[model samples]
Target: MVGVLVATHGRLAEEFLNSAAMLVGEKEQMSSVCVLPGQSPEEFLELAEKKVEELDTGDGVLALVDIAGGTPNNTMFRLSMTHKIRILTGVNLPMVMYCVMERSDEMTMEELIEALLENGRNEISEFGKR
Candidate 1:
């Protein structure tokens, strides 16, 4: 299966992982990283690289970040050139649940990326305004 690294600013990454774990139990090849206040982007990048290396078990890693152009997202983008890492931004609980529950070991990298992009977009909607 593809490994997952939920990296974001503040404690959001950890919270997402915790919530997903509650729904599907703890998953293997999954981890979280947070960019705290006063933390340099360079330092965060190094930390993210190490986590990616640790999580990657030949299936590569899927990194979920809070937003595009942020430190978490930007670092993962940089790491992508050297590692088999695919990035997805705007992570939410539903997306995390999909990654934890539906991501299969047999799925290819392209398929996983496609599924995540679709699922992430589909999770958002205006429900109460009618």
Candidate 2:
């Protein structure tokens, strides 16, 4: 199985996971970490590492950050170089949902990433008549 980590500048990461979990029902498919409330990079990384470890099963890990160049993204980047981990930033609800919903025995991490990118790029129109 592919391990997942979600990190953001605030509690958004944690909150998003919580709500998603609530809606989708709890499963150990992915793990998430947050860098919020003035937590240090080391702490955030530690949390992320723990989450990764919790979800890791010899398969490689993947990280999703809320924004690029931010603390979470930078930390994931630094960690990725030393480990066989894939990091993707600029996370959104659709991306998260896509990742979780697409988790399956038939999907590889690479395929999942591609699906995530495709889903992330989709545009929605909310101005239609209600």
Candidate 3:
């Protein structure tokens, strides 16, 4: 029942949310923040913090970051320490898709995190070459 935030470098974060919405229509529990290149760390932090706060409405917030040790991930991590939010790095289409699907009245934070990580790890492979 927690809120979801997609924060990533460049336009990836916004694109993730947009693509998911396009694939399955509009959603209520999701939002995004895009950290463009050449932006100062302070700027990224402000934007990310604002996005997290906007989504944080008592159910808690979960931030899906694109890369570990990067600006977005690091900023999310810092916010997690102070806010009631969880962070799942290495985000992908599968992760976002699965999270939205499994999120419901009965799903726990642990369960959603597991689904995101597991689905994100699923290989998109071709069985036969064209």
- Considering every candidate listed, which one attains the maximal TM-score? 1
Per residue, candidate 2 scores C-alpha lDDT tens digits across 16-106 of: 7887777765446577777877688888788777777677676667788888899888887887776657888777777777666767766
TM-score of each: 0.93, 0.86, 0.88
Give residue 109's error in model 3 in angstroms: 0.9
Better of 2 and 3 by TM-score: 3
Clashing pairs in 3: none
Q: Which 10-residue window in model 1 sums to the lowest lDDT?
A: 21-30
Error of 3 at 66 (Å): 0.8
Instruction: After the best TM-score superposition of candidate 2, give how far the Cα of residue 97 lies from its true spot, in angstroms.
Output: 1.7
Each candidate structure's count of clashing pairs? 0, 0, 0
RMSD of 2: 2.2
Where is the poorest 10-residue window by lDDT in model 2?
A: 120-129
Give a tens-digit lDDT track for model 1, residues 1-130.
8999999999999999899888887778889999999999889988999999999999999998999999999999999999999998898888888878888889877898888889989889998868
> What local distance difference test score does each model get?
0.90, 0.76, 0.81
Question: Which is superior by TM-score, 1 or 2?
Answer: 1
Candidate 2 structure, TM-score to reference: 0.86
Candidate 3 lDDT score relative to the true structure? 0.81
> Tens digits of per-residue lDDT for model 3 on 36-81?
8689989988888888788776778889988889988899888888
